[model samples]
Target: MLTGGPLDVLTGDYLAELTMLILGRDRLRNPDLGYAKTFLRQLEEGLGLAHERGVRIVANAGGLNPAGLADAVRALADKVGVPVRVAHVEGDDLMRLGAAEVPEVPEGPGEGLPAGASGEALAGAWAGALTANAYLGGAGITACLRAGADVVVTGRVTDAALVSGPAAWWFGWGPEEYDRLAGAVVAGHVLECGTQATGGNYAFFTAHDVRRPGFPLAEVWEDGSAVVTKHPGTGGVVSPGTVTAQLLYETQGARYLGPDVTARLDTVRLTPDGEDRVRISGTVGEPPPDTLKVGVTRVGGWRNEVVFVLTGLDVEAKAELVREQLADALAGAAGVSWTLARTDHADADTQETASALLRLVVRDPSPDRVGRELTGAAVELALASYPGFHVTAPPGPAQPYGVFTSALVPAASVPHTAVLPDGTRLRVGGGAGPGTAAPHDPRLPAGHGTASGADPLPGPGVEPAVPVAGGGGVGGSPAGPPRHDPTTRAPLGLLAGARSGDKGGDANIGVWVEGDAAWEWLRDTLTVEFLRRLLPETAPLAVTRHELPRLRALNFTVAGILGDGVASGHRFDPQAKALGEWLRARHVDIPTRLLPPTPEGNHP
Candidate 1:
């Protein structure tokens, strides 16, 4: 909701990415006006909230223009008469980094997943770095607190680092205690991406007033564990269950990794303590592998999203005819490219003069060449089919298009920070690394696996594991109707967004599915009722119904707690993929059954 990019903001479908040549992996704060507006609004509100609560502050709301944004805030401080000394942590803004000085993408050969190897080369080194902000560690923030900054405005600091920095300043912690700092860092990570997971982009919210989902308020303890809450009377729920649900959003099996540590995220407990309150605790943390993390994307080549409003013709016959003509027109195309998918496909076979959209993807290293070849495709459509020119192919040749490449940058290359700007001196309380564990020598590194979203399996006899070893169920359920809807509400803008890559701290769940079939319609409308009934019946396992596109299929992840090994992430493994193959190979007795909807008639 606060940032750009569909995938970056909301969770849904992202079919594929065209390969991008990496120019460089540099991080910098965006100076875009829109981002700054979002930052300023949140920082002011978060500060107001903290001020009311008698909490001190230093912040990084400077998104794109650290100094410029800071200057405006400084004017505000002058009005409030709060003498705040600000520190601006700099040097990682890649827009300033030279290409010759461009660092190499980290990742030794064969260290990452099959798709994980698309290093920064795809970005085109000649272009160099645009932004290089990392989720910062605790070191720099400590300086800001000591310098006595009334408020800190920095560009591209880690979200969790904002909170953890204060903690370090409050307690004077050293890097040798990085694990404890990491623990607090993880806590901050959970809430950094904005609203509570329960309401923002999270699927479990009962009545999210997205219109006004208040920004989360985290209360960190000495152990590095924190409780996530939100402003009173705001839209959205704050409970252990909701937080736990969020924790499971992106994890692969039972693994949770930090730059210096990987937590075996067990001991997750959610319980209702009172109205709109839940406590989430994760005390057990693992050490991170000494390997750099990176993001990799590949361009499978070019594809034109040609949408057409088809009408007036033997729909199927005309479509086939058009496809043939276009294919023929692209006869010498490096790779023959053609598809005949029509909207309301059910009507494609019998309808005459129906509306439709056609998409064609051309694959080649030379985007210009591919774009050139498409010209004939347009003419064939107009000339080959009945009145085709009057409709889809009207008097023009398809134009050339540029395709983007894919690439990655190492974690070391991503800069993080804490700051004490020029005129403020405010002490940032709290300490870093109160609970971080040491690295295990045999650790597997981050970025070695695929992006999450695999379908889930059925688990057997599962329970919510808590990090504290024993559980005191810290959250509660609504005894009455929910007070607000997090989805429909406006942003309280309590906190500005944290640095780039800071989105990695929250806990996630990984579901598994085997293959792609009837994928566009998750589980073929198997229905949530079936999932609900199936869950209780499993007895010893947990059951979660999700639309998992990774498996390219609808999946039911059953955890042992829900009585099956599905959502629990136990029993499933790399070897189990063979089991998926076995299932695919066998005949399935699937029913074309209707699925039950929620009482409101919305499909779950």
Candidate 2:
């Protein structure tokens, strides 16, 4: 914002599900420490300039304490000798209302199943309850903005609300404006992660200058259509590919649901307005769910882990020895687990080779058991353990783990409200009506088949199949002879760009091609069977694929890869942030025709 020139409003999104738990812990330690400290630090430096320029600020840095954050901002304004009107949106802290009062909602593929539920494997995860804050909407923020406040601090509002609130007030849109609100939501989703829309964490890294990519900005017009762009002379490229990648990032399914509106992503359209700007239009929105989603955090049990590395020959044997020793030492230890991962090779090479990791983790209801008993059992074998066995590091004191469960509360139960500078409280109503869960199928393109959520299947398309030489075309394509040049085994990135992220226990991988020629190959080549071949880890799990021809992208939903959400997941890529890059690295048979004739290896 410092270099991006004057702006009508500025929003900072600082809350995530994990962040809420962390902040709750902090609040437990010190009442005044719940709000994000970084936000205040940034405000101290920029508040004066922002106030001077009439740039309003809205942020969810108010974590578990919006009132406290508002007080700090007011104090800062006094210290800086500026008369600023600061207001905060509150009433999202559902713990104050009691847990039993809030009804639990059914968790879908996006939100992981609630602990102890039939489908959820990890029951009794949230035995010890902590803080539960409902994800809020923009009504309060918009009210604060309309009330002449210079800054609005909110607690746990949906990230998209920060942008939509200002846009709603600026456009004077009513509560029933679904399409326009959905369009604004698309803009907000792109800009919520700052530089993400400007090519940060993109699969095709070499295509853009990401060294110091500029932040994204949405120029929303009167009609709700927005042109996503970055400041001129920015480090990154803001093309259709980058914007679409950000759109698909971290989304649970095609329908982007928030407290304000449920956007139909498949219906949204993107077009190039000019250089470094993409026009977002044709977005349809539905009424938000009647119930508000709240993240419930509880003390999941105490846990400790130790990693032992086995080097050189007999790597597997060494791991087995360690496991055997641990099993003997902790014979009666309950909830103790060990995983032997082979990161070794047979051939002689550097020390990094022929090294395997034996990871041991133990959890118990009693913190003392995990802190002392678990650690002692592992250390007892240190002297008489397998040869070349070395611990990665000392196991620190057992730490408390948090289990996250998402539930829905009636909109009226929370009494959503906004507090003004003069102590005036304004009631903020939730959006129009009850929301409907949209059907999403990742196994096939929209027009090709059935979704898991009982969506009606579309009639089959009658496009002619292209002939290829190999009897087996990738993704089970029928073939006779070569239609293009000979095929070569290469990474899928040779022809496409990808973006991926996690939603609870599931991971969504969105792969897209630039032009019609590449897209034709991508849609046919990267089918569910082919994706399973590329990433064998997803082979055992149920995989769903969805095709968006308008964006020239195919989205695949990998189920249960992350055991749970980021908090207790055992996978190395817990959130599956790197799943896309890993898929791009997997080698595949690429038709030689897809390769560029140029030296730079750019797609034709």
Candidate 3:
């Protein structure tokens, strides 16, 4: 599929937060076994096409051993006879600096640790301090490309850096080109996760054939304006909805922070350029931050969990019974947490309705507490507890948890070095210059309009709409069918599509509509309080909502919901990956006209 051509660069992201911790652990045991071995398999199969078509390849497959990966690639190139010039980027690892040198080590539970977890609880989390790698920028990549390398492998570079580096190198963009860099950042971000920019994980899955979605490509120009597109006859559809979904994925606040420059996502404009092509423009870029982010992983403690199944009448009683039994079985433990989820419906339906689950979790620094004792306590009640006593599954053995700690290091402190195919090493200064660019104006080119003047916030204009009092629905000039009474209730997903994710301990949900009438209805209906009403779980939480009128979207940030992000969150859907879908499933009153027309000419 990659051989179809029509691309300047092909980038792959092979490392993630958890993947880094896992690889670092492996590296501590065997120095040469840290790199992603899958890269070798992929290179062996695809390097020939990449070399033949002259498509530059960049990837961050060098987890903790870029040097070893480079050596392996050299030997593989010889065997394959591809003459591939492979170069690797290094200098993001900070483990050698020791724990004392690290600053702002996240105290307690927040970004990486479990919420309300004590500092001593996570002392074991940092068990084998291997290599703490910082997220590097695109400078190293441009260096390798400039050094005449075809393949550039890196360790701990930001995912988007793969695209940003290639775009920066191809366009000859300097460090001070903030707006252009921001544009490239948007392009890189969209393409970093491959098919995400296409239609994978899209809200409107039925709208396109996503079974075999194609990889996306960014046709970037010197001006930093790029059209996000995929190859012809691809399975996925790329409209404003898909593009907006990808833009809102895993983002925090208005600023999309990166090592190269801070890209203001609010100023971005997504215009449809024919089919399967979205033009990304007007992304304001500011000067890069002085420091780069570093991720450190430590062994926290051992944790184990078991689920008690409650069925039929007195489900609550059944859950309480199990809790009492476990409390007596294992009295001495660091902590024991329990949550009962009522999966049962109101009506007496299938046997599945009797499937409410009561989950019990035990965590301690001592393996014995979380392992045999934790599982044994639950197992002891298998024949002695509640009516129709049964467990969802057998409680598994305890596992050591790793606490991911983050820090910021001076960009200059870490000297990024690029090793070429010929073993010639060159120093690559990280990040860009400190020149701040003006705000982006959608009406004009970024940094060219009123940005230098008093009005620096030149983003999209907020739309004016009257908020309806009861439920949601607006009183305005009807653009679609005549306004119908919003007295009837329907699923919110009928009119809107949403995408959500976690940021640290918080969760962000972006909900959007396609039509003007729907947009007006959503603006008035999907308020913060109303959303809380729909999802009672968020009722007690602090939620802030931001409106993006240009995209007809509403972004809600719910704090402390994920309980210190994905790694430690206790929620069934950790990281809030299904948060948007869950919100969409909530029923809300909607106007008949706002609802889609069925084949029988009735509102769906």
Candidate 4:
């Protein structure tokens, strides 16, 4: 992109919950191998070009070792004959806090750690934690940029910091410029996921050529608003629908808390600027919580799984027989999970089509329990099981998986530092004020807490109304009953687009439509109760519904849906990447007027 378009700064995000654990393991094996090696390779090819073009590069590819990665970058610059000035932000690592000093894991909305876990359990987990890094904000990165660093790398900063940091530096935004900072934060979020803002993973992806969706960029102004667009001639698209989908991805409630500022998601407005460009404006911001989120990763336990193919007739009977036979062997395991996927068809079909799969997953602290014993038991059934007995693959030894938990600590307690290109370390402090643990805004009504079932925050341009007995309002406003328009039972995707993703153990599904009528219908119809009925897995979990009226969208956050975050592999879709698509596929009584016109000029 440096050569493709005019740019002042370029940023890359390469870290995730699982990646942090992997990097922690890498550091244990080799002291200097915690950063992303792929980033180094990319720099070898592009660093010279970026320097020649005077484009400052910011990336959180530093992973667990920003200092080490910074050194690596300097060495690569010398080798490539590029005069690049590199800096890194650090002070995010918290392993220095001994197990006894480690704080108890928080169990708020998106936090992945098990709720009500005992102190002893937390201590044990902390003692063995592979990593415990606080999520730092953009101040450190801004400091690095202002200090004349050509390249800035960071460890465990919020992903959006990659953009916000540069924008802050460029615009000279003060720490208290809540509105402007909030705008930058919103833009940062849209750009942080790379191609997602450009239609990758969009519910209506078929509408565009995403075969090679180009990365997205934001043109931020001094006032903090931005126009999200991609380079010309690039694949994929950047429209209001696409931008709205991204805005709702993995976020919960009206307040999107970050280390810097809490952005009001409900206040965000999106408008079409031009072809392949969406203007983002009017975002409200509030002071961030006094605490910072810390992610702690540890080897949870060993896990093993086996998939049994039950073919042709009596698939259920075959599955039951196998389950009964292996009951004794799996009884000793700490946790055993079974799933029966009936991907079978009756009469006149191919073998694959007529087969069902019964999968068994076991987890235990002892490797032998989940590995040797379980694998042996499953293998023994191969010869003695029901007719047409076959396994998808031979069961392998159990592999250790990580669990990610979140905790909050006073922002003042964590030191944020910037290592300059001149080898001077600068301490960056939170300029927002005294970092004392503050209660959530009490003015924010009850059921507005972090869990599922939380009420939507009042949205911009939406007036308060009496709560109706059933879901029929905007922002829980009593907008009366459903419209008396003709309706058709169809997939929700026919009238709306969606984007869903995992946030630790929780999953968020943001569904949106294009017109006012559709938005009103969606906000009134897709309540927490209705959602639970559609996706039964969410019935028992806490679900929060957030309305973004201006964006014509509703965001639902399902807590504890993924158990212990993506690293735990708790569900088939561990990261909940396709949850929105699943929701969109479910049939709903969509208003006929809201549906798009077919080629025959009729709504399907």
Candidate 5:
């Protein structure tokens, strides 16, 4: 869930380990650093809090740079006057996987610029390596836990381990409790990565002083269920708006097939007990298919890149000439991925079209010929440059870098561990039992208010319910309008799900329940007591949806469950699963479906 980044590095307190893997093309902000460190800080803080609370912590914050990061945590331990143990998950950086080790990786077609492209390479080497990172798992973390280290730092462990490790720490739950582990995994997915649930990206549509939204805080009970909440006073809100946003991001819209398991997002209830508290609860799910999709990157081949600017000549013609030149130089060599793009403005700067700027990107993972072929780009660019000295030029290749993709590895190929660093792992004298390092100063950083912990804060006014959505045992269709008033229905909304829809395609649904009765309670059963008892502590999704008239049918033009990404391969979040299971057991069937995809359209 977290990769190295500023916000993440702070979580080193409690995290026992981390999975810092990066794929070919991803938009994760901290793929190189930010989020990675956040998870690390989680372990550090968690362990620090746990140590104070008398618990152990283990984590893998090591992303692109493990040694440097490990050294950083070691420093924090020194500052806190505690010993920190860092176990490095060695040997998985895919940057080393090259053409020899990975045969399938393509030998790039090193194409150059048409006329003008980019600046020069600071340095020159051989091949070009695509994105690469290791997929270290829980084993090394187990070593850290056993090593008597209060904290553990790792590189590229799976994202779920953030929460899953804690499940292992507290419950001694094995892989058999995969579902439970999955619950914690989802918990991490919601909290650890997003930084603060409601305050983070999810708050985009709503207006709240993000001046400094409350940093997320997770309340982990002995039972192993964690509720995600932020210090209340901080300007941002954690309503259904944000939590649902996190649920859909980068998820490829598949709710069932999540990262670790084909999870099940069941019973989900979001009850705003007071001003800021929203409770999220639920279940994880079934094992994924036998083979996990593995991406391997070795030194594939070499790549030569060049930039060029075209002027006077037609843009298309210049691009064609560059392509033909590179093709001849490649001499029938297998072409890898290569891209030629317009770097600068295509239109004339001030007046009529005089010139255009462009960039050419080429890559081939072929080791032997791949390296030799890489120069093709620079050569072609050099050739083009002779004709128009006006055309700009870019740099050459770097060390031979190539990544190979791997697939279908047996589950056993990777190891699993829910290891905790050796320590008291809990609080000294206490009420809820403190976590590592004297509970991490429990210091509610500035704007964020602490959880009055002394006594329950006085309850606020009636619940501020949003819209309502009904989807339960009723075979994917929405149930008829409930037996409650539209105005106060939300007030009585025991359980409901809602998400706004933008202009046509951009429309979205953040909530999707497993059973109808669950959806019913969400939409029709809001009361003080219901808010208190029924609501969960984490995944506190506050928004609710009620189907409007014309949109009542609830499916896209094509039939499917939730057109919103929730029902896709992504699993039902813990809150939904937990709430859903309870309803399914009750066997209450609301009489409608949500997005039942017709037999022909494969939407769902």
Candidate 6:
């Protein structure tokens, strides 16, 4: 982006929940190999150009070891003859602490934790955790920048911190500047995932060119608002819809809590600014909570799977027979799950088309139990199994999987240190002000301590009722009268767009629509009860709904849906990336006015 546009800083995010676990394992084998190696390779090619253009770099490529990565970067710069000052943020690791020293989990919004999610549980996890890193704010990065560092490497700071830290340093923003800081947080969120804000994985991807979407950049101003855009002639297009879609990805509730600030997502306003540019403004901010979220990961157990293909006649009968056979073989397994996918036709043309798959997944604490023993059983069945018995691939030995969980620690407890280029260690304070505390206003929702026992909405500033364009009552929709507009049963995607993702063991699906009429209809129609009917799996889980009327969006969070986060492989869609698409595919009664015009015989 620096070569393509007038950029002052370049940030790269190369860490995720799974990456931390992988890096932790890397450190176990070799202490010097914990950071992302790909980042070093990228720097070898781009560092010179970045330094020549006076563009500073910031990244969270230092997965489990920031200091080690910092030294590596300095060595690479020296080898390439680039005199760039590199700094790193540390002290996020909590693995050194004993179980008794682990802090309790904080209670508030954004934490849609499942049952048994408590401080005691977190402490127990910490005792056996392979990796425990606190999610720090941007204060350390700011300290590094103020110390004249050209490159900043962080361990596990919030993803948005990359953009906010740079914006704070450039604008000289103080901790008390919550509104401006919050604006930077929103902008940072839009750009954190790189191409997502520019149309990658967008619900309406077919509406624009996204084959090779370019990375996104935010032009953050002094007041904290930013213009999200990419370089000229980039592959993707940026508009209100794209930006809004990104704003909702993997996020819960309207009050997006962070270490730096609590950004009011409901107050955010998006406007088009020419082509491939969207103006993001009006995002209010509140003081951050007094605690920091810490992500703890550990090896849960060994897991293995095998897929059996049954083609042609009696697919269901064939699947049942295999299930009965495997039930005895896997009886010794700690946990076993089976899924049958009938992808066959009665009078099919090709062998591939007339096939069904029966998958068996087994988990156990012992590698031998879930590995060779299970694989041997499945392989032995190849000769005695039903007709047309074939497997997709030979089942391999079981692999160790990781489990992710979150804990909260007092902000003052965890040290935030910045090792500057001059070998000077600087202590960075928390972003919350001296007397600031988590809000407990009665007007706030239930999770925030409201006394009315009413359902909790995310954050504050939620109006008692959403106002409709035409004269009407209140609440989710206009109560005065119901419009008897002609309706057709069609996919919900026809009128609304959705984005879903995982956060630890929980998953969030943010759904939105354009136009006031559509919003009114959606907000009223898609309630928790209705959603349970549409997606049966969510029926038994704890789901919370929050409204962002300003954005015409409703976000639903399902706790325990992902079963111990992405690494556990608990469900078919472990990350729930396509959960929204599944919802959109379910047929629902839709107002004809909300459906987009389409060519005859073509579905919307």
Best by the lDDT measure: 6
Per-residue lDDT for 539 in model 2? 88
Query: Quick one: best TM-score, which candidate?
Result: 6
Better of 2 and 5 by lDDT: 2
- TM-scores, each model vs. reference: 0.54, 0.86, 0.85, 0.90, 0.47, 0.91
Candidate 4 lDDT over residue span 398-480, tens digit each: 99988988876557657789999898999887534333333444433334322233454332212224221223222343356
Give the lowest summed-lDDT range of ten residues in model 3: 461-470
Off by over 4 Å in 5: 1-57, 62-149, 154-156, 171-180, 196-215, 220-226, 231-237, 250-262, 266-278, 287-295, 311-313, 325-327, 336-357, 365-393, 408-604
Ranking by lDDT: 6, 4, 2, 3, 1, 5
Better candidate by TM-score, 1 or 3: 3
Across 29-109, the per-residue lDDT of candidate 5 in tens digits comes to: 434442254654555445465555445444455555554565666676777766555444433343444433321211111
The number of clashing residue pairs in model 5 is: 173
Which model, 1 or 4, shows the larger lDDT? Answer: 4
Candidate rank order under TM-score:
6, 4, 2, 3, 1, 5
lDDT of 5: 0.38
lDDT of 2 by residue, 304-349 (tens): 8899988877777787788777776566555676777788777748
Which segments of model 6 are wrong by more than 4 Å?
98-124, 433-481, 599-604
- lDDT-wise, the better of 1 and 3 is 3
Point out the worst 10-residue segment of candidate 6 by lDDT: 466-475
Q: What does the lDDT come to for candidate 4?
A: 0.81
Local distance difference test, per candidate? Answer: 0.40, 0.74, 0.73, 0.81, 0.38, 0.82
